[model samples]
Target: MKVAIYTLGCKVNQYETQAMEQELRRRGHQVVAFEEAADVYVVNSCSVTAVSDRKSRQMLYRVRREHPQAVLALCGCYSQTHPEDVEKLDVDLIAGTGDRSGFLDLLEQAAAERRHIVALDRSFDHRTFEVLPAGGLESRTRCLLKVEDGCVNFCSYCIIPYARGPVRSLPLDKAAEQAAGLKAAGYREIVLTGIEISSWGQDLKDGKSLIDLLETVAAAAPGVRLRLGSLEPRTVTEDFCRRAAALPDLCPQFHLSLQSGCDETLRRMNRKYDTARYLQSVELLNRFFDRPAVTTDLITGFPEETEAEFEQTLAFIRACGFARMHIFPYSIRPGTPAAKMRQVPKSVKEERAHRAAAVAAELRKNYLEGCVGATYPVLFEQPKEDWFFGHAPNYAEVLVKGTDLHNEIRPVTITSTDGEFLYGTIKE
Candidate 1:
């Protein structure tokens, strides 16, 4: 059968979709793009916000309309949260966030019977981690390895905890084995991704933490660089940074999750850490790893966020000097606490997002400037037109004009900047 998979939202979702594609291919199915004619269409979706929900529905409807004869499959966070919403689309198969192996089986059954199938289990009943083989179809420079799944953090603004269910971890031995396998598959880098990596090991009765998992994976793939996904700020500490810095393969980029920078807004959002603690985490990472790229995500104009609070957030971001930042105007997710609270005007949210974005752009420019005249070991991913694109150990995208640089790690002399990316030449 020819299959087309459409992935929406988060690296974890992407990783799952990649796993699904691998499984389908192992069963002798040809995987292609959604627009191309195919026997099946899989829409792996998200419900992080109402907008995300809308997008998921739109994608499902479009796929159904375009290929009316093809079997339509819907799964992931959106389906997990609202199975009925997805079923309303007249999809052939509906599987929730869990049970990938079972989902694939159901897809096969749908193909055999040519009928609708809905396979959804109570998300909170989920306890076991569904392990899937890592790596993409084509040999790529970077592969994502999901070390953990589900979130226990009930942040007031998030619906993920409900959609993802209780924390479930991949055993340390399995993670090590997957890392070795991915490295052997010719991946130059492995991004340790998850829905909430910080909550890793909580499911285990044995006292293990993310640091322990990182130690094992890093040791397993000493030759391949290991990058991390977004982390809870509260997880970073002097001890954590000290141990993580000792790992030679760990990338020097850290993305801490900071929804709001003001203590009052954080309180409203029910974030685990305050602005001061988040700053401490940033400081600790910088102190341990020389010139590490500290990145973060910020939500501007949260419910009832005053002008004074927004200024505090901008000031806080400027103080941190993030190498990269993703700024978003907070979107109200239905059923979340903040949704029913006093909502910020759309104009105010947009204004605050612009203000935060300007500061972030300035800081990023300065960070790139700091890379000038420095030599970095970059893992070349692919070549585009006249320039070859790759990432520094700090995960900064490095562009250089050269030929035959794919999958090679070489020292590149940073010489110029194109405002966003650093342009350099590989030192022969």
Candidate 2:
């Protein structure tokens, strides 16, 4: 059989799609491009927001229209949360978030028997972590290793917890083994990804923390740089900062998840930390690493968010001085508690988002300017017009005129800044 996969949403979904492709190939099936004729088309969906859900539906419709004879298989968060909606579509196979191996078996069976298959388990029913391949289809230089899955925080605006169930972690020994394997396979970097990686090792009986897991993996992959996924503020203690800074191979870029900047709004959102705690986390990272890139996600207009609250958020973020930011307007999802509350007007949401974006742009320019005359090690990914583009250890984009820089990490001395990226030449 020929298989084609279309993935939407987070890195975890991408990782799963790659795993499915690997399994299909292992079973003597061919994986092809989505545009070409294929025996099966898989849609790895996301349901982080209503927009993601709509996009998932749109992709499904497009696939069915283009390849009417191909068997359509649906999996991931969207189908896990709204299986009924997916069932109404003309899909031949249906699956929830977990069970990739089983889902692949069903897809193969459906192709052979010419029948429909619906196999979905309850979210919380899963107890063990399903190990899958780590490398992605795009690049062999960087891979995402998912050591943890699921979130128990139950943030009001998120539907992931219910879709992914309780926390299931890969054992520390297994994680170390995987890191070693990735290093042996010629990957220069590995991103530790999960639904909430900060909550790793919570379900274990040995009482090891995320820091312990990090230590194990870092030690195993001494040659490759280990980049972390989004982290909760609570994980930013003095000890975590000190220990993480001591590791020579760990990347100095941190993405701390922050939805709102006001205390009352955070309370309504059921966030465990206040503005003060979040600021503490930011300060800790800055103190530990030399000009580390601190990135974040911010939602502008949450339910019942007043003008004063939004102002407070704006001021708070400015105080943090984030190096990189992604600002978004809130959207309603039917199953989340946030959907039932009084929503701010869409115009107001967009307005705040624009304002936040302007501030974000200014901060990014300032960060880039600070990078002038600095030397960094950059791993080139690809080439473009008159230059090869790559990212520094701090996750800053660096463009230099060069050839054959792919997969090679070289010293780059940044000479100038274009307000968006640092222009540099490789140090011979």
TM-score of every candidate: 0.98, 0.98
Q: List where candidate 1 sits over 4 angstroms from the true fold.
A: none
Candidate 1: residue pairs that collide: none
Model 2: lowest-lDDT 10 consecutive positions: 133-142
Query: Could you tell me how far off, in angstroms, the CA of residue 32 lies in candidate 1 after the best superposition?
Result: 1.4
> What RMSD, rounded to one decimal, does every model reach?
0.9, 1.0
Q: Write the per-residue lDDT of candidate 1 for residues 1-428, one digit (tens) a residue.
A: 99899999999999999999999889988999877999999999999999999999999889878888989999999988887677778798998999898999999999989998888889999999999989986558899999889998888899998899999999999999999998888888999999999989999979999999999999998889999899999899898999999998889999999988899999999888998999999999989998999999999989999999988988999999999999899899988898988999999999999989999999999999999999999999889788999999988889998878889999999998866989999998
Candidate 1 weakest ten by summed lDDT: 81-90
Tens-digit lDDT track for model 2 on 1-428? 89999999998888888888878888999999888899999989999998999999999999989988889988999999998888999999899998899998898898888798888789989788998877755456788998999999999999999899999998988999988988888889999999999999888868888889999999999979889999999999999999999999889999999989999999989999999999999999999999998899999899999999999999998989888999999999889999999999999999999999999899899988999999999988899899999889988999999998888999999999877888998898
Candidate 1 local accuracy as lDDT?
A: 0.91
